[model samples]
Target: MTENLKVEVVGLNRVKGKHLVAQIRLSNTGTEKHLSWAGEMADRTRPLGEIKWASGIGVLDAQARTWLLPYKPAGSPCLCSDRERDGLGQFINPGQSINVYAVLPAPSGNPATAIVVTPLAPPMLNVPISDEAPAGDFPDPDAEPVTLVNRRLILPAEALDKSEETADDGKDLQVNLSSDVLFAVGKADLTASANSIMARTARLIDASASTTVTVAGHADSSGNDAINEPLSLRRAQAVERALSALLTRSEISFQTQGYGSRRPLYSNDSDEGKRRNRRVTVTFAKPAPATREPVATTPPSVTGLTGTSKAEGQPIAMEIAGLRRLPGGLGLLTYEITNQGSAEARFAELHHAQDWEAYKYQAASNVRVTDVAAGRQYLPGRLEVPTDDGVDSYCACTDVSGIRINTEKFAPSQTREFFNLIALPETPGTLKVKIGPFRELDVPVQ
Candidate 1:
């Protein structure tokens, strides 16, 4: 139960055998007052009837590590409950149970289940997908379902540092090495550490089924193409030569290209983003799938540790419940916060953490998941949203506003829960979850 409301995820069904539709039943059990859907559930960034619709609703594809948002056809509104069009108004009356729905892009690869994500409630995990049509008219009956190309990140089990990382979209795998670590500034010659990076990359290639490897180089937005394009190509050539020497398979071939800031993984607005944009990437086909057990479901019980947060100058207790692997390729980190004192407590320390600084909104975006055995840390999952100007990235985690807690003045003895979505490792193991100002908890990825 979240904020005196009970939520039931009915099912995710296929519409026209192309689009995926999700139906959720929301019941208002709180006797105090009516609930505002927009204030609590809608994604604040949306344009129309934001408060009246669940436009921010998302479906988490665990296997692809992607968040599928409500899809809308060109020049049309989001395929969700219309503003004031449905019988329910901006608010849900007390003791009233209503059903809200959203149309999302059907996930590729035909996943068996998806994690339903709403603002205030605990994630509806492993909700089975059905072939039956939903009970009402489609949100946009005339519009056709178009497949949108989504960007996927390869969550690595082991990492050397922030300078080198890898991400995959379940199909192709990419190993991204920062140019600063691979070469001298403005030069294409391999640096001292390049050999070790290439050796590690060679091992990954040796295990892959692909015989042709593509090495691509990218530059930051600092210089023009004349200076960047040739330099990037040279960098790719250098990486190709090193890989050819280190790789054991003699028949494997290499293809190289230079993209001079034409493609970027992150926005170039900040220094960190710019540094990440300047990179050399090796792309190849992932190895064939092996027979493995189905993705595990989270346990129904709650068990965790509680600690105080003195950094916020308030008597608040932070509890890290546990980390459990969910069906599909993700993990759910459950936690809660309690205000112990009479005065209201604000989570300033948590909102200002380094990991969440980029996201100014009030959410549990600061949490980090560390694979204990692999010695690698991961942030919350990210999804790219197409905007008018370009694409924007957001953390695929819980937004605290959906939970019934005052952002500034958390009442005395008030406790609020949070659910964060994170990408899981290829193999199940123990995980270390770091919540705000709380000691890290050792949680098994069961």
Candidate 2:
């Protein structure tokens, strides 16, 4: 029964100007298949598929008197029971819930009176927010349960002030992806496998859309500008070409620039530094301001809690610090491991890699948080391939041959750092991080 499901607005924000980021939740109430609500025409009759994804969703801002549909950019990677499309739907499992993010126009008005969530597409699943639940009307509880389908959520007025404020993550979206992953040495052609990743990146860009798309290319100082400059421009143009095809739905103006060994992010003195410098940054323009308004409320502060942990006789010291927020509702924590012992140690083994399925497991799993008051433990959020919450430095940078590429050695006095990104809690409290099978540290939230 689609009606048995409840919708909750977990997070709302006006980012990149004129854009709204809403994190919503859908909960299923019934345990049996009779009330199951699948989001598809074919599966609507079958209770087994549960909630088929690509279920259309729309948002209505009651105060501003406008409606917003789910934003899906073409060629974007989508996944809900494996059916993800750019600007399409996703799935929701039974008992458990899933979070869906949609970008829309920021609703106008102080204390938006109410916001409504409507499940579009399948008419049977549509829950129109009208009045209270009908008396003794359960809709058989097994058929297309249409009771309590529409969720009329009230919006906050104070947080919706009509004053100009900068977005929390900033106005523009910049992604600096390593060129090595997209091209071969000194070439502008994309690898065969890179196309899929580029498509996914396109969708991410569409998520934070803009009227202008700029692809800036950089190169290591291996060659002179006379040669490197053109190479860099070609690379940027290649990216522009791919993006142009993927963002056909958008009317974005495309531009490309080549730095040609200039403006290096890292000193191109070593191979690793060169790898870091040879990169392309895709910048998307923020929307033009519709009107000066309080874009959003101050987000919860993200700070690092410095502490140390060690395993007996391992001579390994971990300085877990450098905590910060990620794009979504995720936070990242870093652990710096220093080998104080007389011999070298493999960094992978120290991280309990044996139980980690050979670096295939998401690095965040090594971390679990506990709310001191509730005594409930929370796991990491959903992540894509190379599961480890590992930063690029820690995450596998395998070549086309599928070989593990990393620098995971910690010699005496040498230090290596690992990062874990996990879903964060609202009104953050004192959180204890369970790291590996060896150590635990408490982080008090402010």
Q: Give the best candidate by TM-score.
A: 1
Please give the clash total of every predicted structure, in order.
Answer: 5, 12
RMSDs, each prediction?
Answer: 4.1, 23.4
- Alpha carbon lDDT of each predicted model: 0.70, 0.47
Q: Which predicted model would earn the best lDDT? A: 1
Worst 10 residues of 2 by lDDT: 156-165
- The TM-scores, one per candidate, come to 0.82, 0.35
Look at candidate 1 and tell me the lDDT of residue 23.
82
- For 75-174, candidate 2 gives per-residue lDDT tens digits of 2211122234323244434576655544444444423322433331111111232222222211122222221111122111000111101111224545
Q: Candidate 1, which segments miss by more than 4 Å at Cα?
A: 11-21, 43-45, 69-76, 104-113, 130-160, 219-229, 250-253, 259-275, 288-302, 353-362, 400-409
